[model samples]
Target: MSTPTSPGEGAPTDALGRALRLVSFAMLGGVVAIAAVAVFTVGDEAGSGVDAFGAILVSVVFVAAALFVPRRLVRPWPATAAPNEVKAAGQLRSAAFLSLVFAELPTLIGLVNSFARGVWLPVAIGALFSVAGLLLTAPTADRLREWLARMESAGARTGL
Candidate 1:
């Protein structure tokens, strides 16, 4: 298995890995910031039971998106480019960004619920899911390389 590499920590050939690491960390930071705000401001009591229900619904949707969107976004392109090609880098970056966004959605929704309904449960749930999902699905250098390898293999098998 390839060891995970941080931004600028790998050889020159690992530029894509470095870039992906930076992007992933930045996205994770944003999610964490939103969660922090929700967690810190948990005393508002303006939310109705209906708002709580809506929060539940949103949380479910966010979980579903987090589970499925990354796989879909990382699907191999039709091009026959090599795994190390520039096209692969673009695909990897796009996949990482989209995945991070999906992972962060629950936290964003939770923050909004906190502000709009002042409900604590929804905000708490959203914060939990956001932090957990972001940590669990964080993009690493190894993951980027693995994805590229899978894409390259798929393209070759399909004769793209």
Candidate 2:
């Protein structure tokens, strides 16, 4: 027999999804704000060639790190630790925020370069990389469900 869920039963999950989306938008907003500030302060000025190749290379490395580091941080629970879905869910939330921070690095670097060299190219490159990272890492309801299911199975196995 199955139990009927209340109307507000899924509110937490829905709220989580909304919160993650909000965070994603906030990161994008940061990029926009940086761009606006750069434009207003620098005023269409082309900077004296601040090593375009180097900036692009650094951006690529940071983007790659942003994509890779989160998986390491979200590792499975150790055998000694009792499995708790609530804890797993909290870990997921923490990991998501950390991932966003890593993803935002490119944009922050671009902002620094923009301010130092007074060029827009660095900011644009950084924004592109960060946007891709942010979009790729944004958590969805389906992903949350899958993660919970996986964690439950792992708990079952360990609890046996």
Candidate 3:
């Protein structure tokens, strides 16, 4: 009888890609959950435009962070030797983790603003930004291949 292959028995890149996608989807779902919670609990305590200013500004900054921080995190891999799949996977995972965390920040901020000030606009704005960030940074198969190719090219360049 043939023994069944384990979940992680695939190539490192494949396994890592699957894990990243799962985490990304979970984070996106959390944004939806935040919206549901706010709808059910937050009251129509209409906030002044001035009161929403801070939440809007903070959410914008967090969304920008979600867009840029992950690229910086993965940019410093030591390509002095050769591109190692294991090391590349580690770096990708780190970048993806930060990407998801940063993306989720706006939703959390929105939830806080809703509970504290009862403004619903920030929740909607934040959820929109959060979803965009999550979708943009999601580790799909094409993205994974591109990243690996870039790492390989960098390694080749530095090896000379």
lDDT digits (tens) for residues 1-160 of candidate 2: 0111355556345666678779878887887787667656754765545546655777788767766776666554454666464676576677677778877888788778877786777777777778887777767665544444454443442221
Query: Which 10 consecutive positions of candidate 2 have the poorest summed lDDT?
Result: 151-160
lDDT of 1 by residue, 1-160 (tens): 1223465565332666666667767776776676666666766564677766776678677766765676676665555633354565566677777766777787777777787665566676766676666666667655666666566554442121
Note the Cα lDDT for every prediction shown: 0.64, 0.65, 0.71
Clashing pairs in 1: none
- The true-versus-predicted C-alpha distance at residue 48 of model 3, in Å, is 2.6
Per-residue lDDT, model 3, residue 140, is: 76
Q: Write the candidate numbers in order of decreasing TM-score.
A: 3, 2, 1
State which candidate, 1 or 2, has the greater lDDT.
2
Off by over 4 Å in 3: 1-12, 76-83, 156-160
Worst 10 residues of 1 by lDDT: 151-160
Candidate 3 TM-score versus the reference: 0.78
lDDT of 1 at 114: 80
